[model samples]
Target: MKNPCVAHRGWSSRAPENTMAAIRLALADPLIEWIEIDVHLSKDHVPMVIHDYTLRRTTDGKGDVKKKTAAELAALDAGNWFSQKYQGEHIPTLAQVIKESVGHCKLNIELKTDGIRYPLIEQKVLECIQAYQAESEVVITSFHEGTLYRMKRLCSQIRTGIIIDGWRNSLPKELKELGADFLSISYSKLNKERVELLKNAGIQIMAWTINEKRAIRKIAALDPELLICTNYPERWHELRAESMELEVVNRKK
Candidate 1:
């Protein structure tokens, strides 16, 4: 199967990661078929686009993200950390993301677990998906096993991917039992033998945070069904050609 090239944190290189500008940049790229973004809840139980527990690093703020209300987070500058050109960009809501992404491109929402209020996050996320009728184009993923499990129970329609940062032989039995749609593991930890084994079992494998061309080539050779890459969305066409060329060379051998 042709692997889907997903933009990690949107086209993070073009704009601040997980912001409206980033989403716009990614959707404008024809080669980008899907985008992966992070989500977390604010003090008011509103789900917003962000990757960290604290806002100090990514935004012009200095506290835990969960401690701030949506209005407070909105007041901070989310873009200046990337570039001064976008100094006052506000954190986007899950509803805004869903609305904009509805028919444009597939979305992979990575639920951030640090300081999480599970029920609130799940409720807000599911509500946004329902509001936009985006169930067909959305997949929920998380590093938190509990979050993924709860998602599967709450909404079986949307696909679920368990994010693993380690190298383990046995796929989490709970993920399999809960009917997860796929497994997303770090590219550094995967082996070709395991890739083949998973493929043979009809389980989908998606490698995360792949950005380098060399790593892209290596993963393409393993032939996973999807690649969740960062910044590499800009080189989508070049990498795809590389994948095709590798296939031809393998066939001739």
Candidate 2:
């Protein structure tokens, strides 16, 4: 099967990351199968889809995102920073994303609980997934091992991935014990030996934030099960097509 192309934060190259506009753009593209979104809890513990813990980078607000209520966050201008073309886009809640994404595409929701821990985030996210009946089409991921453990304990049926920035010898063993479905890692950390180790351990591999052609091509050569790219999913699509063409030629030769 061709490796799936996961949009980093929707088609965030054009729209504001984590907004509904970005999700819609990614859904419109046939090449993208998985839409990766970051989620944080609002003051009221509503799961809001966004990347940073702070709102300054993506929104017109000036404080920690957790400090704002969902209603307050809804009023912020989330699009103007990227482009005026999307001037009024607002951050979307995880429930809204799940509802909108139903029958459209799968979601890779990365719980943003690394630096700022949000109590019961796992429960809130799982509740959203269950409410939408999207367990078949959702994969929950996080850098927090405890969060992943909580998710698995809450719902073993829910597919889970652990996002790691660096290599660890105990990662495969840990994932196995945690009942993780995959390993989401930085593109630079993938090597032949690591890929073999992961594959041997029955773990799926996903590489992230790859945009440049060279980096994308290099990671593609590793043939990860999923390529999480920002700005240029089309490039990944092109490279995959080219790789398939080469495979066909080699078989005939």
lDDT: which candidate is best? 2
Q: How far is candidate 1 from the true structure (C-alpha RMSD, Å)?
A: 2.7
lDDT per residue as tens, model 1, 117-196:
54578778888898889988988888877887777678888788888887666774555776785777898888888777
Q: What are the runs in model 2 whose C-alpha is more than 4 Å off?
A: 224-228, 244-253
- List RMSD in Å for every model shown: 2.7, 2.0
- Ten consecutive residues with minimal summed lDDT in candidate 1? 114-123
Cα TM-score per model:
0.90, 0.93
lDDT of each: 0.81, 0.87
> Alpha carbon lDDT of residue 205, candidate 1?
73
Instruction: Flag regions of model 1 displaced more than 4 Å.
Output: 114-118, 242-253
